[model samples]
Target: MKNDPNFIAAYGNIPTFESLEEREKWLDTLDKIYTEVNDNFEKEMSKYFYPNGPVIAYGYTIDGVLKVAIEKGQKIDAAKENELYDLFSNYGQNIAVKDVPLIIVYEDLPTPTSRTSSWRPIIGGIKICTEKPDGIKQSTLGFSAQTSSGTKGYVVAGHTAPSIGDQIWQPTAGPSANKVGTVSKVGGHYADASWVPYSNVAAKIYDTDTDVLKDVKSHENAAIGDTVYKSGITTGRSYGSVTEIRTSYDNPLGTLYRQYVAGYNCDGGDSGAPVYVYVSGGVKIVGIHWGGVGTYNSGYSTSIFSPVSGVQSDLGVTPLTA
Candidate 1:
């Protein structure tokens, strides 16, 4: 009531009020008017905003109301459904963990060492050894393999099959491969998989460098909502939140199911990259990047990883030390 001088004078300037009792009376009147007006408004709005059926808005802090857009006519249990409805409705005003939906977006293409402080060069950019290289063009590919003796090995992605005796070289110190190890076995159609002696690299490799290894016992079992990081030869370093876990998908390589996360952008040479989780004191290796499910051009898609537990058991190696 901007137009009402009496209403303004009573509730406006404090010193202007004639007495404390008068001021209290004015405040009480104002509160009553506000409640009545709000109640009327809510009643009117309810008619237009009535929910169609069972669907509910998840993040609201007030009584969860079904939206009109939700599919109508579906039968829902009265007792159980009302409880679900109440949870959403009453808690709608409270901050909701699931309310915010974040999608992976490319702010920039990451360079080596951009995301992690411990990053270093892996194998000084792949140098083609010969002008006419044999056995599948020597393309870089990512791989995770375990030896018969139970040693876990990390592999670069490519169609070239490195035999059991093939000598592999990784940088002894850098953001990428800090330790050198040898190929013990190779598998997969394009020889995309290869095994290394876990014992040889165990002391040299940091747990932060591979997803298949973690030093923290608390994070040994990761779940949804945890934030994770990735280190690779290509695309260097990136970070993202876990969107899914224990999932499966099909690829040209084969049908596979593993833990998955979103937000990191990995490329061809990043196949053997390690996935890490950012924990309280340090980062832990949780999985290995197998392949990406989405296109590389847009770069906002889900990528799959093989868990570190499986990798550890297959390779028969102890976890990497932090």
Candidate 2:
């Protein structure tokens, strides 16, 4: 085609390149144009992003395709796809949600806030609340862990207003009789995590479906294409795939960064639940579920998590894998 004068006339002049370096150099101008347009698109496309109206949206790579990912929902504006198509005409394109390989499917299965009286040995996935609990204040326990000094404890959502010495309880509606532990340490910045020190524990998670205890033998970070699962008292155990990494969301807690978003369903009171994948012998925890797409804080109703790495670094506690 480079030597065909007829083809050149039909299209346009093709850049000539004899080396790989030359090819990249020839494409630099195109790259610059795409960069500038996409940058501006981000600023202008905010109107159609998640939390626009009960939607989940973010940018990430899936199956090697980088996209301005957004959940297709009934509440979203009908013209959103059209607007996006027009805006990205030159720089990019939009794919239908059906065609997209990964998406957060909402189950919205609401479980009662109140749980049983108590369990002799506490575990993750069960509800835990503050002194008030108040249903809203209560959230799922992230997992069991131990401080560097061997102090046994548990982890939960930091956005639940963690503070040292703060009394905690298992089950959302605690009546003091259900007292479990107290906040010993807290995580901040990119990880929405906190630790509650307690003496009694199973060092595992309460599996709702199997109605058995599942061991967490290790911890790992979430990758873009990995399949992840969340175990919460409210939603039970649900599976989804990791679609976003280093994703950021702004809320009352803070603008969390490097967060992971798994294409799974979750609801209120699910926060602080453990996110993980099944390993050879047991489970390797990946993250701690926080809030996602909802009516609050431009929410995406997506399942957002603070990876185990950041959680460990922030709280100075190692997840009890044994």
Candidate 3:
């Protein structure tokens, strides 16, 4: 027997290579052929994925399993979301769970749009407007507090001020009586920040996903080319890098100095949104968004944010650490 009687009976057609290079060539061919076959299989399988939308990604696993990923905060219908599992036996594969496996993982991710609707929570990333729409001073609130003095409050655009003790309502289009808080303090030339004290406050912010809050740790200074992120009622949430730090911008209230300019843009109501960088556990507040030269145009434009450290000093408020 060349090797064994049983082996020769079923595998005698196995190829014999005269040289190592010949065998290597055949092995390379096998790898390409197998990969192409798998690619086609995946392409056809994608048709059955979540067609209704909101899917992050989906594909076939290495071991012939099907895997799908969705947003963490999305609501899933058991039967609808699990339709793939019901057909496990249809493709001549094993019907048991272990034989034809399916894996679904959830992640906390931002939605496509920013939140402009009225949020009862006094956290950041929601719309806030004057009680009477006095010229429609819509703006965004930054994170709340956990300071050394044990004082609690929220921050917004100083230009969005309707004067101290005046009412700030969520969703300027909603009910007139839906008051959230009042403007407590408006800073000087150092920072365009307004403090609005409220009980329902947290050191968190967001874009559309109001239920899932991202914690704000402390404060940091933005550097050129450093990554930045923000979510505002008008412009939504977008990612960009700090193109310039210690930049200056002139405003009607005063001249803001050492402001951070981001590559991303903002809109009219996006003022006072949090512009921060993602840190290890959560994020650090870099500044409070005001506006950029682009705000003078008719579309989304570059943004300016007053550095957080100076804003805290000017406003005389302690920032949240926890």
Candidate 4:
């Protein structure tokens, strides 16, 4: 439509928001378009974009414009672009193509087994698992919930859990001693967080600095420029800001979407660490730390996170509070 703000924004022009409510109103429209486009991509669009195809991958709205990252040597066909444009309408026209194929997804190389001597308190970022010899550790103990069995369970990264019924323990326990919990459910592949059927873990997160104890209460989504914090087994507690969201990339199993990116230092053992935003007196769960790319201060490093809401929906649990 003529004079549409989305249209204006499409041509590299800034769309003005008269008030906070107006900005949110525009964001609602943009988010809806994003959701509809992504839902269609997962359901019907992915098949059309295969290896070396026109539409290699889709991305969420960045600066109110939807984007599609194309293969190195090709561009999206006009017809397909138009179809998206028609769907997104004003903002959809902003859907543009880039040389790179969205975000690149990579798996972390397994680290060599190294043992820590003493048993540490069970908290976010501490290693805990059922695997023998060397047990896997908890991500950020993302949240806790009262299960249908009336007992409480905590959250961790799914890929870290070796099996559904595996008994969880601290790494120092070496398969026997410090039993902490068990993996009640595992959601692998695109869904990364798993559920552990135990309440022994505390809601507080451990920081490498040993100063701040991140207490997570509610869950929220990351926005551009929002300062975020994460506690991981490898990197300990790190601070960064959200740079991108509504992002996606191709993984081994399939295409993954609705992921966020931050400028933080993260490593292999850090997977499943709780990523949250600090609020008054506590923090709000935002995303679960996963594998990231590049190096810190190198101008290319970025920490990737799976939205906490997605994990909650998949695992049917919430972050533990007080």
Candidate 5:
């Protein structure tokens, strides 16, 4: 894929550098370019789907083109989903149809609602809860951070709270599990995360590989194709690549911006899982895993993450470090 003419023209044309700083600087430029491409594609192509039809999602791909996810059984242009897939797969890239440039692809995917919160209350463990009538649901617990008042608090999905001050527990129903924290604040429209202050859990992540603890040092903005990891109760430890950065996804929860997509195989309970990449010495936090779509095992599925830097700024907290 790297050597493809279209891919190189759109994504691989960035300058190469030997120094990490220079490499990062170049990646930043590429990131901005991709973000603009994404924004332009959304503005122009979004009207082609949704409210008007069955298209559920429209976003940019790593190849710098548009991707549309339609609901199962949904049809477009009087063509069946499979037929449209073939047509796009075989000829979409060859067609230069817009000034913004687009190679539209289709996938059958849909969003699922959150259920009740229940699980083991490890720092990076699963935090499951219900959204009223949505039934049982789950999300990952991001590590704790120092609030503006110097208080410490862990983070979870805002949708899990449903209401502020809701008691968040380890196991949503079991007798042995205990209440770790309560929903202190929900970022509702700003982010898919919430602060849980006064939690008994420590500001440490359970390493699934070493079976040890790794303290989070700082937060970071993810770049496309970066290798990141996440730990959740459902999927345990998962390693995936940042597929898209600075993208927008609209769903029932709300439209989240400056978001990124990863190929990590995550489940429902994995929401809020801390996404990080190993740096020179310690780990740099990347994002908080949210919801995902498409078949989990399918190559096309992706898990959404809210940039950790954005989360911290919006919530007014700094990641707790060793």
Candidate 6:
């Protein structure tokens, strides 16, 4: 049976059977047992006599028992099922079913979100100012900065509120301009704000060719249940579902202001990270990492971030040129 080309074509090549007589004897025994079964008698007899009747031999083994499923929709009777089970239980223990093959119907299943890899940026970093006079301390998680004209900025969370002309670092790699800039504006909660490049730093620091900030005049926005992603120098990257949106409140430090975007866990160094929307082509920066209420494992609680629209409306800054 293993040497047959038709069988080999369907189930791939296998070693030839040791004895044709032994193989024939085993198949004959299965046929006889199936023919005697009352429920499957007619079907079995027809197959036994017909040129193209369904064959009833061992198909394959899953754990220990020989698997007896239909090659096609060819139905089996209760009696045949019982007889086959009995035969397998009584004398099929030592039989090798590994070389046996069976044809099965295929079905499709849903793809899980956990296995999905899709996200992109919508907004880019800009500078802003704080309305209050008191400075906010830098945080381990970081804050989002916004300009009065609505331009966006990446504020170092928990860090002291930076003043005008203060040199700021653009963690992104590039030329000297891409590496650093000076504080320009300030406002809002936590005194989180934006800074402008004192030199051609914006062009030098950001990858004008790929950085979304180089093109998008306004930051991206997101709604509840929207998909989002974030990336930073600290935390590599991550994706999650947005559980909430625009929310306001206060914290022990001071009055907190931000839009809540829920998702998976992020860490302290991830502060000031850029949040993006996942698209087919690339990532679109939508917001900046401000702070969140929950721990990483418990899942994202209310993650606070600055909106791109607010950044644009507050700051007249446009996306950098290529």
Clashing pairs in 2: 292-301, 293-299, 293-300, 293-301, 293-302, 294-299, 294-301
Model 1 misplaced regions, further than 4 Å: 1-167, 171-181, 185-193, 198-221, 246-253, 298-301
Please state the error at residue 291 of candidate 2 in Å. 1.7
Stretches > 4 Å off in candidate 4: 1-25, 48-57, 70-121, 129-150, 188-190, 247-253, 293-300
Runs in model 5 lying further than 4 Å from the true structure: 1-55, 66-99, 109-122, 126-131, 134-136, 172-177, 188-190, 199-201, 246-251, 296-301
Evaluated at residue 41, the lDDT of candidate 2 is 41
Better of 1 and 5 by TM-score: 5
Query: Per-residue CA lDDT of candidate 2, range 159-180, in tens?
Result: 6746777777766444777788
Clashing pairs in 4: 127-137, 128-137, 143-319, 143-320, 144-320
lDDT of 4 by residue, 30-57 (tens): 5665666766764545644554244444
Residue ranges of candidate 6 with Cα displaced over 4 Å: 1-161, 170-179, 189-192, 198-218, 249-258, 296-302, 319-322
Model 3 Cα shift for residue 287 (angstroms): 0.8
Q: Tell me the number of clashing residue pairs for each predicted model.
A: 25, 7, 0, 5, 16, 46
Candidate 1, residue 309: lDDT: 56
Better of 1 and 3 by TM-score: 3
lDDT of 6 by residue, 1-322 (tens): 3363223112212234477665445444433332233234344423421123333222222111123323233544556545545543333233443333222211111010100111111123222222224442112212233334555444333222335665443322234543344556543442233434333222111111233332323246765456766654333456676643322332222322334445645544444555666443344556556554432443343355555554444433333322
User: What is the C-alpha lDDT profile of model 5 across 1-322, one tens digit per residue?
Assistant: 4463222112112234677777555445444444444455445434545555555554455544434455556545534444433333333233432123333334444342231233233465455553345554555577667787778777776666646777665656334355676776777444677887863555567657445567666677777778788776667778878766533444545545567777877775677777887765557777777767565553224677778876776677677776
lDDT of 3 by residue, 1-322 (tens): 2363211111112235787666555434333332332344334433443334434333332223343445445655666455544443233132222343345555322111117655665677777776434354667777675445676777877766736886777767357556777877777556778777777676777744545567777787775557788878777777677654331323445434445556776776777788888787778888888775322455355566778876787677655655
RMSD of each: 18.3, 11.1, 21.5, 7.2, 7.3, 24.5
lDDT measured at residue 51 in model 4 versus the true structure, 0 to 100:
47
Q: CA lDDT of 158 in candidate 2?
A: 80
Global local distance difference test of model 4: 0.56
Which should have the higher lDDT, number 2 or number 5?
Answer: 2
User: Global lDDT of each model?
Assistant: 0.37, 0.62, 0.58, 0.56, 0.58, 0.37
Which sequence of candidate numbers ranks them by TM-score, best first? 4, 5, 2, 3, 1, 6
Best by TM-score: 4
